[model samples]
Target: MPSGLPSALYGWPGLCCIPLKRKNTDRCPASLASLIINHHEDSKAPQLALVASILGLAASLDWKAASNLNPFEKCMEDPDYEQLLKVVTLGLNRTLQPQKVIIVGAGIAGLTAAKVLSDAGHKVTILEADNRVGGRIFTFRDGKTGWIGELGAMRMPSSHRILHKLCRSLGLNLTQFMQYDENTWTEVNEVKLRNYVVEKMPEKLGYDLSHRERGHSPEDIYQMALNKAVKDLRTLGCKKAMKKFNRHTLLEYLLGEGNLTRPAVQLLGDVMSKEGFFYLSFAEALRAHSCLSDRLRYSRIVGGWDLLPRALLSSLSGPVLLNAPVVAITQGIHDVRVHISTSLQSRSLKVLTGDLVLVTASGPALQRITFSPPLTRRRQEALRALHYVAASKVFLSFRRPFWLEEHIEGGHSNTDRPARLIFYPAPDEGALLLASYTWSDAAAPFAGLSTDQALRVALKDVAALHGPVVFRLWDGTGVVKRWAEDPHSQGGFVVQPPSLGHGDEDYDWSFPYGRIYFAGEHTAHPHGWVETAVKSALRAAVKINKHWSRVPSPEKQAILHRLEHIHVSEDVQQQEESPEGHVFVEAIPQVQEHITVETITPGKGHVHVHHQNIPSHVHEKVFPDVHGHVHEKVFPEVHGHVHEKVFPEVHGHVHEKVFPEGHGHRHMHEKVFPEGHGHGHVHETVIPEGHGPLHPGGHRQMEPGSQRHRHMHSSCKGGGGT
Candidate 1:
């Protein structure tokens, strides 16, 4: 028997034949004698492991213990994530034309795009406006004390697979980023309490909460409110859901849909450190909530987050033009011309012509650049009116790790003071503490104040959260970062407006204008995350790679051939029902007989439906009937671009509609830019990334709402589609 084999298999009850490696002939004891079979292949390790697990379950009669082995875990599998990962691990086919590519920004998005295109044998050049790289991934290290402060993107969720893949590829070590801890303190309205006693907060703080909202935490209240507002969003599909949900602000959603009392809503905002973002769009809040949900775990890169970008910079074969801001872009019939301003005093310019130009600059940065024919009215409007939330951080350097005395480790402490959220650095991360972190309206006050003034205000908040003891242990040094004050990035992360577009605000920010392509967190849905920046980079790289010839060498063809499979599987999308009563949905795979069964009464219907794992289609149903009879509907075989009506004999007429490519739904999508290493307040913005979360409204192109300064949003997880 192999050493790695389970010990339980050796002491099983019944004696049976076991599947062994090609050279081994072993008789294994198992209870499932009839199911035993002999296999003579070296690749049977996985099969044998499965059999062992099943036998162990059967013997122990512990179904719950083996729940992890269940196939339902496949429901969590994202085809888009898998396909994108494959692209990162197995790159695109070499280009036949080998065109020249110009990447506008040297941020994570631009760098990733440059690396991919360069690896695919394209001539690539990166023009960075700032002197340094790593746009929002700013890590400030004290020269003397060696303490580090994350001014921009500090932590990310473990579910952000694409980012994890990039970090792993770069050989960066990821350490646990303690986002929440039960021992953490919460101070609001001059009332202090531990997180474990959170359920009793309303009573302790004397808030007149409603009966339903009395016992719940702010997170719970938010979740309940979110569920109520977008309860039918999934079944209703994207277009309908967007229109339905995007009409209100978070405050409105909480009051109307959530049905929470005014006091309860205020308590939630205060406790969650989101009072500044109360007026933000409920749709955008949901987008941020999708990524920052409690279901995910957060971590930070060892050393600093900037290491990932530095590693990416080292891996790139292309040249990066530092301090080179693109002043103008002119599109011609053949290619695109980018004018780079080399010197401020000399008034000199350098022009670079590229077959494709990927502009990874922030929206505000884009407004400064002149375009030849002028961008589309919608694109220009999106650039001009896109909302980037103001975010600020104040860091305090202590002589010792005094918070540990209070048993406060890596978690954050929330307060309703000027410092909305305070992050305590890990024990191994030196004695630097993120004293004050504010977003949206909360950050507005800090943005106008000088570094010294902001530090003083933050210290007062810290003293209020902790005690007067903070003054004794403080090293008399502080640092502040205000995203609004940064010239490179005008704001922190983006927060979509209540109405996506009706006036100046348009939702089509990601679409390419002529040969000028956009690749940034802003271009990605749930924007303002490092992961999204990487995803956008990958997207731009793929689009540019698609410009090459279909015919290539055998090896290159293999890569492209694999991509064709991905496109076939991942291209299937969800759209709204037709104007008429037509509900277009994908056929569920693994369901050989009927995909859905329903019981419909006179008006109400119960539907038991199974969703397909295919990327092209989603599992949806008309309705189940009232009676016990299970109506079996034979779905028509769906092929590429074919419109087949799925007729299921139900109580009412079945309305199934599927939009062919480019027909029904569409959307459009920031970064936090970090500043200098000095204490003068190095403000940085982080744009969330990855595919939109699972919602009734479908893929959200709108950027994420207010996010914690040090911790990332859950929306940063991997998924495919632009």
Candidate 2:
């Protein structure tokens, strides 16, 4: 297998089997099967590989799948590995009936979902509010000078494994993003200092260390304390250990047990203040440090960040609608209906229906759009509680590298001044400068200002830091991007408050809410970076895959249960016990053998299993299990009364499982009942996004253009950049 396959084949072996995209992404067997195995390899292997690839297609992503699904029930009873191997000899795959997916937003998360699902042979269509791709990977290039400067996300770090994979797929080149080339200067309050990349950095704005703080660099000290505090949180048994840090704010935690000197605290406070320190939790902040402490290689896309997004768009199999904003999302038992605006200025709406719907828009944007059945209180609350960070990037391109006149190539000049952090681009004579990259309060003063005013203010501060000599020769034009003011995003990325718990990452935010699932960086553990956004989208796509081709498996049900309980937040937990959350269901009374317990992605849903005769005209699709048994065909919508007929069985114990919404029941009766003595019951099986009541609302009320299911493909556009 090693000799015949490409050298890069081993990068994602174990991960390739799962629905989720892990660090390493390898070519799927479906695409490479013919190329890999031939008569020389094995004549029948290709057929087996095709079947195995079917399983690969269906089994796509969840962070928790690896934990519960142990080799799909560990020991197999029938057509064992060797025998099953005769078919798809080289692979163990499950079949999938591809579905229609409607993805909102053409950001990294949205595009990634579209790419993955489409690759798995699913019909995908993307709707983007901005008439362009790449949500935050915004770049501005000078037509005359051909100089590129970032207006949104900047450099890519080597540690961003997922981003690198995409880059690898696109065959994009990466060069050093001289963000810290010269270690520039600092201009705080009145004190001005240079970023002297010497043995000791003593600049007084952000990364400078005084005599007392000499031993610990900001990165080193923050990482050391975080590691010590979160040492237990990373492990499974740290349940009680997490509580101690959960209640405190980052400031309080930093000051705990005299962790730093007075000056050191002030220094740390100045830097962290750029982000929200008062609201951020100690645990969440600590997790952030873990990524920073690891060796970082700050590099940028060779041409510009925008190129990467464009490249991603090119790789996608389907068309993406530009300027198409989904005004309403109506989720039905069968499929989801999304009514999107054909154009930003047009009042006309188009209805797009998909078996699965994935919303990768910012939370604020999501909130503005109506959920036909208003999102459950749980989902609405999460959306409301999740706050977005307000930030702005101020960019200026020059005819020549003025910093080079002083032997400065690239690097940042930290400051508590309104100008904030100034980053230098390449050493090229004509390059761009990130004059001000500020967040929170530091960004407020500049974010709302006009481009000229922002450039004027930023340069004044820069002049103060490095003297006016650096700007004697300048290009008057500048680009100022304040994500907070963007009409589409509505706000910057999501941030955690002190009230956010450590285990909040495990919360099932990515779980499909009915037929719709949410993605974007905010949905994943690492809330800020591009890598997290792509990874998060993959998880949502995988979850949708599981929902589409559900099979009867104890491990899958258990895994879905875990996904269902991901909402361990105290508020949500309390809501589960509340009145609206109450749920009750009773199905078949007994199970003689493996009564096919078909699964949909776990949610507050009820299941009714009948061991009696089911009508053959119902048209059920059967899926072969690891063992010889085949599970019953499943449908997307389970409305009113469902005739769930399975094999006959008698008296058995009730299968108990807890869910957030009104205790929705899933009856997993053991094989204790005798054959031909099946008991029947009347019950309702409905699943919502959260543990809450499902309300039937009005029809989608599609407008004139509703017949056009696809988002109209048009020239990409965005809010004009200065």
Candidate 3:
């Protein structure tokens, strides 16, 4: 038996080796020496002899070469022996200390966090309850249509910097987005509407229109009304707006205003209340409007919105273990150990331990996670306070452009019923694409339908707008997605109910968790849109960056000042009045010591006043000095025809004596000789023989300095000219 061996090692082991004293070599089994030599040469030898000899047992055994033996060299000399020793050492080390990390979900956020941690020199394992990535962003392809449709999160506007940056970093080619212009069509009361500018209508109806135009569609009109109402409320101040309109619904408020006709109100109510399903008070609607109005307009991604999440996933530098579900998170003082189960195996669990853990799942998923210490009441209350609105999208591709066929004389009438239509010509194809949005109750019918069933209903609606809708060619490339069903995303976006009351408290509630952060359309300020997404992500990133380093708030006041100044300048420019009124010009030449009376049309034919011996260069700078005193020099007699003019005499320039045909009632024409000069032209006061005066709104041809005695005349019809 090996010296110092435990009793357990010697008593019950199946394979045992005993060391016999050299003096009692006769008792040693003959196979012992042969076994050692054969095993060593066979490269399948047990390490007992090697280890024992290295520990000074060879000296007791009187082995001559034991001192010179190199255990590592001997092991390396044989491939099988080297691998066997390596396996044993690794097994021993693993038994002493193990490593593990737990990732919460398989969605984009969870996958992203896992990939980041794994890349940063940590052993990570992802626990995904779902079978696939891209939580709410789903792509569906119909075999019949041969086109792919994005059922969820379809659009990513150009302003999505993180997404765009990731795409660039991943070397992915992004497609340019098509503008939703005239090719778009909308349906109203089952009648096809076209050529409408929905965003501009509210302004024409005496309501203030702020925010970018959303074009002509029910969505645009709804958004416009909501936006205008919000601006009106904000102008009145938040406190006052809330106090005045908090109890009223949008329908009640609009009806009270009496700004909309009954039919229009009914149509809007059907679309916004019934179809949109947004049951919001006037205050809530205004808050939502204000939030969304601050964001950039909606836009679709190049290929689809899926490109963004995929790009983020492809850029991950670590391995992502798919189908691995996390069972538990066990944390110690210094490290956290995660228990995970793989789909391939059930009995044994894989453990990953790490220093820090990040949970990126949704609110509901966060609720499901069992924290060892448990979350505090504040965190729990926050999770409960945050509510998500159910959002669903239905996309259908038609065989051809059908709405274009049913058009009146000049395309479509703006005042008529069909004016509410929204249509946009498809990029790279002649097809027409129409998209519509509905809220709460309106979303119910389409929410439960499968992709095919949704397409059928949509096509039927489309057919009703365009006569028979004969072609019936649905590419079947339709997408139906219910965001409410997603475990990671319990709903599409954050929407406040009347009960919650419109305020920032709910938003402020979600931001207090330690190290753990929330981002996405729901957490976005002012709600769902590409701008909000980018802004929210940026704000989160900034918060993280600020936590890592001390950064001072920039001099934003300067920018604000500049913006204010620009607004002031714009207001001033917009207020510039058109020169519609008339006035007379009375030129008083100091040197000549005489006044020349000339009638000036405010916005019509020019009036000429002559001053002799004036330098041309000086007059060029001083002439047309109607900048200030023109308003005071009004001549009431020719006030309807004469506008206003002030001709400042040049210091050394001379004016021609002959009066032009259009020189209205030119009198007191004078000539002045230079102080030291001799003969100078005399003032004739001759109206070029036949020319009388400048017409109020007519054209006349005359040469002030020419001696041509004939006058070419024209009469004034109105007090203006072309």
> How many angstroms is residue 251 displaced in model 1 relative to the true structure, after the best TM-score fit?
1.3
Please give the range of 10 consecutive residues that has the lowest summed lDDT in model 1: 665-674
The lDDT per prediction is 0.60, 0.53, 0.38
Best-first order by TM-score? 1, 2, 3
Number of colliding residue pairs in model 1 = 38
In candidate 2 the C-alpha lDDT for residue 221 amounts to 43
Residues 1-722 of candidate 3 have per-residue lDDT tens digits of 45643221212111112231222121122223334445667776566466435333422432113212212112112223333232212211111111223445545445444433333333444445555556666666556544555566545443344445544554656653332333234344434433233322423332232333222233344433443444544477545655555566666665554243444555454433322323555555554543232121234555555665565555443334444445444333234444444333222223344433445455565665544223444455556765677776555566765544542211111111211222333334334243323445555666666767765665555455555653356555545566776655667766554444444233442242322344444554445443344333334333333332232224322322322221000111122222331111111111111112222121111112322221111121111222332232212122112222222232422232322212333222222111113222221111111111111221211112322232212110111100
**Number of the candidate with higher lDDT, 1 or 2:** 1
Of 2 and 3, the candidate ranking higher by TM-score: 2
Off by over 4 Å in 3: 1-127, 141-146, 157-179, 197-277, 281-298, 325-332, 337-351, 397-425, 429-439, 450-452, 475-479, 499-504, 507-517, 530-722
lDDT for 497 in candidate 2 is 64
Off by over 4 Å in 2: 1-95, 197-212, 221-243, 271-278, 292-295, 344-347, 500-506, 550-686, 689-722
* Between candidates 1 and 2, the TM-score winner: 1
Candidate ranking under lDDT, highest first, comes to 1, 2, 3
